[model samples]
Structure formats: structure tokens, C-alpha cells
Target: MTQNPPIRRALLPATALLAALALAGCSGGGSVRVAAPVTTGSTAEQCAALKAALPATLQGRKLRDTTPESANTAAWGNPAITLRCGVGTAAVLDPHSPAYDLNADIEESGGVCWVSEQTAGGGFRFTTVRQQATVELTLPAAYAGGQSPVGLLAGAVLKADPVVRDRPFACV
Candidate 1:
């Protein structure tokens, strides 16, 4: 039996570890799956503008590619802080809609207002309030105790989607 060199012995473990990590990453973890919203005409144009203005990173997470590859959707991080532009107005924001909530906590950060609702998964989904083209963000439960991620995208959203003056909802 021949003994392997010290460097070769060390390289064997490292190489094996690398291969294992690569396989783990290939098992449906590389890209996030997000439902893309349908938009047309001016809304589609606004979504495109918002996409262009999005930051390359959010919080400390580098932006990752989303599945289905839509210009209307973006994501960041493993748990994924996802954004879908040109979404339909949520019922909570519609005064005439039965789902409207008079006591909704409309939060304002970085000059944009949002209506947040908790999801069944313990995460939170926030939608832009009173914007021409609604933008929705889904924050994973892992981010619950952290600082608000909304401020990071505020500038982009503010520039891309003008406020709908006719809408009754507004951040107090």
C-alpha cells in the first residue's frame, strides 16, 4: 500500500466537501420561486422602471434570481425578501372593498406608505398604499425582529409609481 502525499490527503477532503456543497445547491436552492404579476400598458411600464431602479442588494443579502425570470419580480436572500411590482391593489387598501380594514396599520418609511398583513407562514406581506401601480413585498418570518426592509426600496418605488390621489388609504 502506498501512502498519499500530505497535500493530496488534505485536498481529498476539501474536494469532497466542495462536491457535496455543489450538489446541495443544485437541489432546488439556487433560485427563489415567486409568482409574477400580470401587468399591461402603463402599469407594465412602471414595473419595468421599478425593476431598473431596484438595488442590487437588500439588507445584507445579495439579490438572487427568481424563477420564471420576470422583470416584474425580484428577490434577495435565502429565505427571500421578494418583491412583485404591478400587483393589484389589496382589498385592505380598497375602501369600497369588503376586506377593507379601517384600523390597518399603514406604515410610512422613506416617503412611501405600506399596508402590511401577516401571512399563514408567519411571514409578512406588505403592499404599497395608494400607488398607481401596486408593489408587494414578502418578508420571511426570519426577518421579524430585524429592521424594516421597506425603506431600502422606497426610493425606487416612489420614483416609479406615483401616488393615486383618489385612493382613500394614506399613511398617517
Candidate 2:
């Protein structure tokens, strides 16, 4: 009987990962399905629009199917880049007393503005500043790179709802 070469077997995992990534671009295949962020009424409507505009793939990860199938929340990749729309005001948003100093923690990237805070587990929390129903995103430390989630989320949402950036606040 003939058998595959050792080198072929060694390449299996890498081959599988590439296949999965290609599938992700088609649908949110490789993404982790998370519980939808809770919302009601018009808030839900707004989030739905944001959801509709979210990319099929994010940061080389697919946008996974979320639990409860809600437009309020989304996740991508294994480490799980989670994004929640229609979020309540974050304590750091208080311009009078920001959770962190200006431009230090809260900075703009890819045209999206956010206030960042490190999670206890060493992950990061990035929340939108100018939008009405705040959008919060969480990413693991290893995912840190030039490709910012802020830019992606903001582009998707703003394109869907041009006026979503209501109630702008200054972190001065």
C-alpha cells in the first residue's frame, strides 16, 4: 500500500488553516459565535444597520455567526474580536473626568475615535467616543497591530447611518 510522505503530513495543519481562512471570506466561517448584545426598540434598528454593514472578514478572521442572531453584537477569529453596538455610556467617556488622559488612552485610528482600556486579562477594550449609542470592541493583546478595529467598525457604521455620530463629546 502507498502512503503519503512525512512532509505532506507536516503541512496538513497549515493547509487546513488556509482553507478555513478562504471560507471565512465567503461567510463568517472561522469566527466564534458569541451572545448578541442586548438591545430594544430603535436601538436595535440602529444596530441592525451597523450589523448589515460589518465586513464578512475582519483582520484575516471571518465574522462568525452570533448567538441569538442579534445585530447588536459580533465576533471574529479565535481570540475573538468582539464588537457590541448600542452600548451604554462608558465611565471613561466622562470628558470632565476621563478614565484615562486625552490622546493617551483615547485616540483616533483609521478615522474612528475610541477610548481604550486594558482588561484585567491583558486584553484591550476600545469604545467609540462620538457615536450616539456607543460601540465597544474587545481584542486580545496579541492582535495589536496597525489594522485597527476602530477604523473598520466606524466605516461600516457610518456608511450605513451617516448621522450616527450624534452627541459628540470632547475628551478635552
Highest-scoring model, TM-score: 1
Best by lDDT: 1
Write down the worst ten-residue block by lDDT for model 2.
Answer: 163-172
**Deviation in angstroms for 37 in model 1?**
0.6
Instruction: State residue 89's C-alpha deviation in candidate 2, in Å.
Output: 1.3
- Give the per-residue lDDT of model 1 (tens digit) for 43-152: 99999999999999899787888888998999988788999998888777677999788788898888888999887888988999778889999999989878878998
Write out the backbone clash pairs for model 1.
Answer: none
lDDT for each candidate structure: 0.87, 0.72
Candidate 2 residue lDDT tens string, 1-172 = 6568997898899999888888877653543666566788766777888888899888787777666577788888766788888887666666666453544466766555677887777778888776655688989877765466677677876665444445555443
**How many clashing pairs in candidate 1?**
0
Off by over 4 Å in 1: 1-29, 95-99
